[model samples]
Target: MAFLRPLGDTGLTISALGLGTVKIGRDQGVKYPDAFTIPDDQAVRELLALARELDINLIDTAPAYGRSEERLGQLLTGRQDWVIVSKVGEEFENGKSRFDFTPEHTIASVERSLRRLNTDYLDCVLIHSDGNDLEVLRQGTLEALAELKRKGLIRAIGVSTKTVEGGLETLRRADVAMVTYNLAHDQERPVIDYAAEHGKGILIKKAFASGHLQAGHADPVQASLDRILGTAGVGAVIAGTVNPKHLRENVEKARRAVGDL
Candidate 1:
């Protein structure tokens, strides 16, 4: 079985690998290495079913990921069994991106996410930083999320930080932190170490370097998985794949990476 670990003190146990739902919704203005067709509803449902069969409980989505929340609300049936991780501070429209971190927008965003996700509360909500992670935190975004947590609208709150300083600040104040870590780039490693020492949840993005590994190098997937999952304090690595075979291979790699631990 794949390893399951606690997401900090959020009382949520997540599998070593989480499913990212970006390809399910938005295909425009994406950073993925290749262009691909967005899966239809039936195809997405099948992929999600495969994820559950692999014991992946954490699903990472965002309002900026076009149509993802609404599609999930439509396709996802059993809500309580999965840990839905959504985001604030970013929205996509007309093939462009916009950001908002005001307290009102933050609260309203969470409410809108709840409705779009067809759930009363979100398990985790992270600040989708527009590369200004510290400013977002200083401008009352984290406060609004904390208020929501107090009101039972969200269970855990954190930030998807871009800079090391911002990531450390988030760990000082939040329950979890999402940072980009992979074989090619590892500048945010200090954040991971801080989370490990402080008992904060750490979610890795771009675990496969946005498909950059597929081109060069041998066994890049296994190498990436081993590096990230072998590190302490890592909760889950969010890998976005619409391909069932790819997803299965990732889960198997994760299982091998976190063997017996």
Candidate 2:
């Protein structure tokens, strides 16, 4: 495997293929809610160890992902070389989820994330967007992130946007941006191109489009990823998998893409 890829000119670099721990300890079949089963903690730990052995450094998780952060923390104890990235927004309640990004809630979420991840500082913290416009992008939240960065609580900050326009707008202002792209929902080319051109790291989510590609629909996956990587600003792609074999398959795909590059 390769070492790591720089997210931007800001000296931040991570593995090209990150492990999304949402399904590691939390409920499975989350993408298809009717069928859900959480994995054993020990299995999740072994998975983390395996990823590290493979030299995969970045582990992406979210507070809403039940015990994912905690599981990763347990698995990654004493491993400081790994880059842990997490997001804040969306809370779980009554077997449902709610979104909240007020300044106070964001800070609280970070605190909880720190405790859960058992980490002193997060490598990156992305603002979880609810598909909202910039009007809801809080100045206080940005200020809080700036404060965290200043205090060394977070190494960098970013936003999770669902549209190319929003991603571009975030790239224009934020240090990094996570956008949805893949064979299933490839709609952020312009923003990704701009990010690549301007030295912004573009993290891709939903590469498989919630199991659609895994169901023998590989063309869209290949074509979409090819198109995104061909664009300017893409930094790394985060594709989640609960199955180890499938995870390795995703890693192979990433390696092939990078090799072609």
Best-fitting candidate, scored by TM-score: 1
Q: Model 2, range 45-153, lDDT digits (tens) per residue? A: 6777777776688889997777788777776755577888898876655556688878888899998889988888998898888788474464466567767888899
Model 1 poorest ten-residue lDDT run: 209-218
Q: What would the TM-score be for candidate 2 when compared with the true structure?
A: 0.89
| Residue lDDT tens for model 1, 54-158 | 889999999999999999999997898799999999999999999999999999999999999999999999999999888888899999999999999999999
Worst 10-residue lDDT window, candidate 2: 28-37
- All models: lDDT? 0.92, 0.74
TM-score of every candidate: 0.97, 0.89
lDDT for model 2 comes to 0.74
Compare the candidates by lDDT and give the number of the best one: 1
Q: Residue 27 in model 2: shift from native, Å?
A: 2.2
Alpha-carbon shift of residue 62 in model 2 (angstroms): 0.7
Clashing pairs in 1: none
Cα deviation of 79 in candidate 1 (Å)? Answer: 1.0
- Provide backbone clash counts, one per model: 0, 3
Instruction: Please list all clashing residue pairs in model 2, or write none if there are none.
Output: 195-233, 196-232, 196-233
| Model 1 residue 117 CA deviation in Å | 0.4
